[model samples]
Target: MKRRKRKRYVSTDIRKSENGATFLSILITFVIVMITLPLLVYLLTYVQPVKHNNELSVNQFFIFLRNDVLTSEQVYTDDDNKMYFLLPTDEVAHIEQYQNVIRRQVNGRGHEIYLRDIDSFTLQPISFGTQVTIVTKEGREYEKKIAHYE
Candidate 1:
């Protein structure tokens, strides 16, 4: 009887394929994460953050003053009825009071009650506040939320 020759089988390179897939997956995920991080941070800050001076209400200002932040100075009200409260530092407090104000060129305009004076404010770091400035579709400026010092 004649004997048949044995056949040999060759192994496939499966490791290369697996490594390529792993690398690709990791790269794609990293890119996606990096892109989303900044957007998320921007949204959070835009929705809320610390200190908004552009537009503040009298009630809000009063709240800060009541906290013993503003001394007898660092405040001014313009002649046209614009109230200016500037706390330069621990040493300089400027206060002013005015009335019948129109639009203040220096600080912009709304109503007119200028209160101006110079005094000293105690320098104490209270809790921080978050300010949000967002532009509306109609081109109006609105304060979203008043963050309190907690």
Candidate 2:
């Protein structure tokens, strides 16, 4: 009787294949980042945040004030600090400054900040009621008149 010889099977090298995939992924990521970086920077350079100017702030304040006070039963102002009132929706809303930001709070809830870099905020008396005046660090001032309903 003749004995048959068995052939040995070799397994694939996992280390080499693993290293290649890892290196390729890393190289592709690096290339993508490199390609997008310049475009991102360019877009950022042209992209300016909505400025916190006095005019815009005052206008926005008046809009909010009108909307709130139109149906409010009562309103109060702390001059440069804040204005609190009841909205038409029966929700209480307060607009005030926190540090350098102008924030609005409603129903004792979230503090929604609107404008930033406010140097000064003042409520000035007007023909009918009061006007909001916001001054920025650049010495630019904005004012808007408001009306109160009885």
Candidate 3:
């Protein structure tokens, strides 16, 4: 009877080298990560925050304006393009562009800044309400139509 010989499989040196990541591959991966990390951090920390803050501020301004208009007894824009809201308590809220900022005055007193870095602010009387358009110094345009309660 002939006996069958079992063949032993041995891993070569080349096979061992290819089994895991080499020094060159690890170094290249580290270099790629180092190159991309700073750019990602810069975009997340610097580039996005400024624009995001600007937009957030503008939105908050709009919300405040809308709330003031909706809760007021009357809303009107004067010949000088300044907006006025007559509240239920007989208090007048005046909103106008003062230099490079939009300010709010209560009964023609106090300086309350609503928005800053403004290039232009316009209030156009629409059929249903007023269309407020603001142009920022950075060339950004934002418009919102706030409706009157009555």
Candidate 4:
């Protein structure tokens, strides 16, 4: 019987040198930081509570205006710093007197009042609560409760 000698196995090197590995790690880290920096800045600046008021106001304005019950004629900010919603009405007598400003009249129950001559309204953030009011062309007013934004 002839005996055969076994060959020694050697491990092949797949990894780069220590310095090259360190450089590659640093490059990867820098790329990740650059990609995330702008997103972080944007979220910190634009998506903060500091913009809550403006965001709520703009959303409220659009929502109330788009109600199907009301017809929008004109939307303008008045000298009194109040935003006004202009509406047209001919159903009720003396409604023409309040062509621009909304008119309120006490109901028969006296607990609530009806309003007319308003196109739409936004609920300004008030300490009391979130209240939305709207008016139709037929001189009808509708009020609704809304969720308040923090």
Top candidate on lDDT is 3
Q: List the residue pairs that clash in candidate 4.
A: none
Candidate 3: misplaced stretches above 4 Å? Answer: 1-50
Worst 10-residue lDDT window for candidate 2 reads: 12-21
lDDT of each: 0.39, 0.76, 0.89, 0.44
For all predictions, the C-alpha RMSD in Å is 15.2, 12.7, 5.7, 15.3
lDDT ranking, best first: 3, 2, 4, 1
Off by over 4 Å in 1: 1-21, 49-150
- Cα lDDT for residue 40, model 3? 94
Q: Model 3, 90-142: lDDT tens per residue? A: 99999999999999999999999999999999999899999999998888899
Pairs that clash in candidate 2: none
TM-score of each: 0.21, 0.54, 0.69, 0.21
List model 2 lDDT by residue over 45-141, tens digit each: 9887876555666577668667767768777787456777866678888888788778889887898887777888777666677777788777788
TM-score top scorer: 3
TM-score of 2: 0.54
Task: State the RMSD for candidate 3.
Answer: 5.7
